[model samples]
Target: MELKVSSRSHGDHTIVTIVGEIDLYTAPRLQSEFTRILDESTTTLMVIDMSGVEFCDSTGMNVLLSAHKRLRERGGVLEMAGPRPAVRKILQVTGLDSVFTIHEAVPEELLAAEPQA
Candidate 1:
């Protein structure tokens, strides 16, 4: 399936939502999106919404890892949210689940407004 990627800002975070399969053919698109977000945005936290991802191969995984590494090098953070069962299993098997802060969903606290003093 074709890959779709979109990004938006939420508070101090930038959320990138990705849908469809991610294989060797489609990984480049995702990588490009990540590169664009990292280069264009100054947000310290980047959360990848993987709920719509149906499949991911090693190339795709590498792209994610590279993005995580880049963010870390810049003193930023890379997180993942709502990965499907199959993709979750890949992360677990590859030990990436531990490398990234995995969220069941984009954390509500990030989306919530700060209480006025």
Candidate 2:
């Protein structure tokens, strides 16, 4: 299924909420969204709200890794929030769970303060 992505800015971060299956066919869309957010905004953090994600594959993992790498290069970070069971398992099985910061939800404290541009 095609993925749906919507984003909002929180402090120095951008929270992108994604829904649908994340596979080879749909990963590029997510990648583009990340590229756009990173290029167009003064965001230092990217939070992926994966609560609605029904599935995730290697392609999806690659997309996340790429974003993480890009952000880290700029001294930024990528966080994954509220992933479903299947998606979480994929991350765990691939030993990628340790690679990202996982949250139960968007950290309200992070949203309360916007970093200087």
Per-residue lDDT of candidate 2, residues 21-116 (tens digit): 989899999999999988988888889999999999999999999999999999999999999989999989999999999998878776566455
- Candidate 1: 10-residue stretch with minimal lDDT: 108-117
In the range 18-90, model 1's lDDT, one tens digit per residue, is: 9999999999999999999889888789989999999999999999999999989988999999999999999
Specify the highest-TM-score model's number: 1
lDDT score, candidate 1: 0.91
The residue pairs found clashing in candidate 2 are: none
What range of 10 consecutive residues in model 2 has the weakest lDDT sum? 108-117
